[model samples]
Each structure stands twice: as structure tokens, then as C-alpha cells.
Target: MSDVETPETAEKEELLTEAEKKALIALRRDEAAALRRWWQRLTLTPHELEKLTKQRSLPRGVRAVLRRCDSAEAAMLTQGFRELWAMLPESTKQTDYRDEQLQVWSCIALVAAELRKEESGVSLAKRLGQQKEQTGKPLMSELRFQQLLSCRTPEEFIQRLRRALALADKKGVSVVLLASVIALWWREHRGRLSAKPTQRLGFVLANDYFAATSGYSHRKD
Candidate 1:
């Protein structure tokens, strides 16, 4: 049998000083680009856009609010609608949201709520129940749209992310995957921010911090 590259073997491969296997932890510019673009097609089919892109306009009031702020995260929340809609149970798609923003944000919220499950070891239902208690109903409620829209300021945004990660189940979200999304999002909106040296996010800090002490284990040089 071939030795498939599970996380165990992959980490072992990273410890080896080989040029070809560096992509397991490449964390470089091109590698970061590869990571982010991977999410544009979470379902990975070209023919399904009709179902994904059919909704042309959000309700009038909802459109006005989303137009004001321009952040990479927001754009991802918007473009990610396709992936979100596809992943949902077909039975739930019939849910009648109270307003257009509520409908749109539902897709985004499902993704955000993922953070709560991915970052922790709790069960999915319990975490969601706690969230529901705060609103005095379930997450499916259109009024709970505020839970998703609460990220108006930096503090609230951080809390929203923190809550999702802190509360969700152990197998919840993929860290490497989210890292890739942010990596791509930054590239699209980087022009608005001040220029700086090239950067990589998510998994690089430890690799970078250990370079000197651990003898540059990930580099071929």
C-alpha cells in the first residue's frame, strides 16, 4: 500500500529537509495565494452557479447597510453566499426570513457560527443552544440576525469570532482553510492599507518563531 500523507506523516515529512515536500508548510507568498483561492469553489463544480447566483438583489434596506462598510471579511461574507447556500440542508432553504438582510446574513452566520464549533471540543447542539438562549430562541430565527450583524466595531467583531471559536465543537472548522480565506481576502483589499513587507497569516508564527532554535527545520537551505 502507498504511504498516504495523513497529518502524522505530513509532519514527519516537514521535519525532513526536502525541497519537494515544503508545501506541507510552505507559508510563503505563492503558497498563501494557493490557500485562499481554494475556497472560491468549496463545492468545486462550474455548472452549479445557477442555484448559487440566482439571487440578484437583496431587499432595498439591507442593500443600503451592506454598501457602507468595505472590508475583506464583508466581501468574503458576501461572495461566500454561494458556498453557504449549497452546504445547507435543502429542507431548511424553505425557511422564510423576516427581511432580506436576515436572509443574506443567514448564509454568512452559518459560516461564522462554524468558528464556535471548530475551535473547541463541545457538542454542536449545546453550543448553539447557549447562543439561542441569549436571543430567547433558536439560531434559525430571523431576529437572531443581530448575532451575525453584531460585528459593527472592531471589539464586537473580535468577540463574535472569539465566541464562535471558543464555543464550537472540536472538529468544527479547518484552521488551515480559514487561514487560506484570510490570505486571499488580504490580497484583494491590501491596497487600502499601508504598505509593509510580505506577510503570511495563521500557521507561520510558530514556524517562524522556531526557525533559529529548531535549526530551520522547514527550509531546504
Candidate 2:
């Protein structure tokens, strides 16, 4: 009878352990679902969501660099790189050969990509600087002259270029344009702008708004 009682108690303990494990798994799933919903609320597109949702936590130094991103767009790019790198297997990451050093290289690549896409050559050159690193070489010719020439209007192109420059972590010729935009917004929309960094981003959005408005104009005046 004593032996039977001991076996029965052991089986009951195992059942409780299994029940606890199920509860913990349910809790983790619930937490993950809540995180996904919150991320969706941040206005990430499907592509961006896929990139960000799969990342492991960044190392402290890398996370600090990402947090220091000057623009929301740059921050998005940083997040993209982090998630992309994290998705790579440990062996793949080791083969790529830079572990933590990859963050700085990735920063340069991201800034270069943005500049090339936005046709901000003058700013790109300044950001690339006097001492050229191997990472900077990959971007030198990716930014083409023809892309800048395709602009419909000089002002439109300049504004887009300025926005890209403003996002760069380094000093560049277009820093003046960035400062001017900030000052203009501060003067014109004092009440709305305030101390909020995001409010100052109206300059970038204003370009799109103006372009849309321009498209609707008829020359009948």
C-alpha cells in the first residue's frame, strides 16, 4: 500500500508540472500577440513588420547607435538591418566576418543607400569624408548623376536631397538646409512645433504635400 501511494503521488506531480508548462506557453503566446498588435499600431508596413518582428534584442552598443538615428526613416533602416542580421544563422554571421563591427559598416551602407536613392551627392561626399573606409567604396558609384537629372524641378529634388541629408548621422553640406527647415518650421508653426522632435519632421512631409498639390494645378490663370 505504501509503494502504491508513493507512485500515485509521483504521477500527480508530473501532471501538475505538465499543466504549469502549458500555462507558461499560453502566457508567452499571449505576450507575443500583444507585442504584434502594438507594433502594428506604430504604422509599420508589412515589409517593415516582417523585418522588425523577427529580430533578437540588439547588443547595447548597437542599440545605442540605432537610437541615435537622426530620422524616423533612418531608425527604420537601422531596425531593418538589425532584424536582417539577426535572421542570418550563427555560421552565416561568422562567415560575413564582422559580428559587432557590422553595425558601423551597416550604418555607412544605410546612409549611402539613402543618399543614392534620394540623389543627394554633395551631402554624400561630405559624409563619406577625407578618409575612405572599405565600406564607403561600395557606395561611390551606386549614386549616379543621371538620377539627379531626372528631377522634374530643382526645388523638389533639393528638398528630397535635404531630407536624406538630414537623416544622415554624419556632418554634410546639406546640414544648412536641415537647419533652415527646422528654423522655418519653428518660426511659422511655433504652437504646433514646440519641443517635439517629430513635429520638426514636417519639412520632409511638406515636400510630398506640395508635390501632390502641384500635380492638381491647372495652368488656366
For every model shown, what is its TM-score relative to the native structure?
0.23, 0.20
Off by over 4 Å in 1: 1-153, 181-221
- In model 2, where is the ten-residue run with the lowest total lDDT? 1-10
Please give, for residues 1-221, the per-residue lDDT of candidate 1 as tens digits.
Answer: 21111223343333223321232221232332222122222322345422433222222333223233243245334434433434333333554532332333332333332341232122222233333333344322223323623334433543444454444342344433333323222332333332432333222322322332233233345
- Model 1 clash pairs are 115-164, 115-165, 116-164, 116-168, 117-168, 117-169, 118-172, 118-173
Task: Assess candidate 1 and give its TM-score to the true structure.
Answer: 0.23
Residue 79 miss distance in model 2 (angstroms):
6.1
Native-referenced Cα lDDT, model 1: 0.32
- Steric clash count of candidate 1: 8
What lDDT would each prediction earn against the true structure? 0.32, 0.33
Q: Write the per-residue lDDT of candidate 2 for residues 87-146, one digit (tens) a residue.
A: 323443464435432433233223322321221112233332222243323121224322
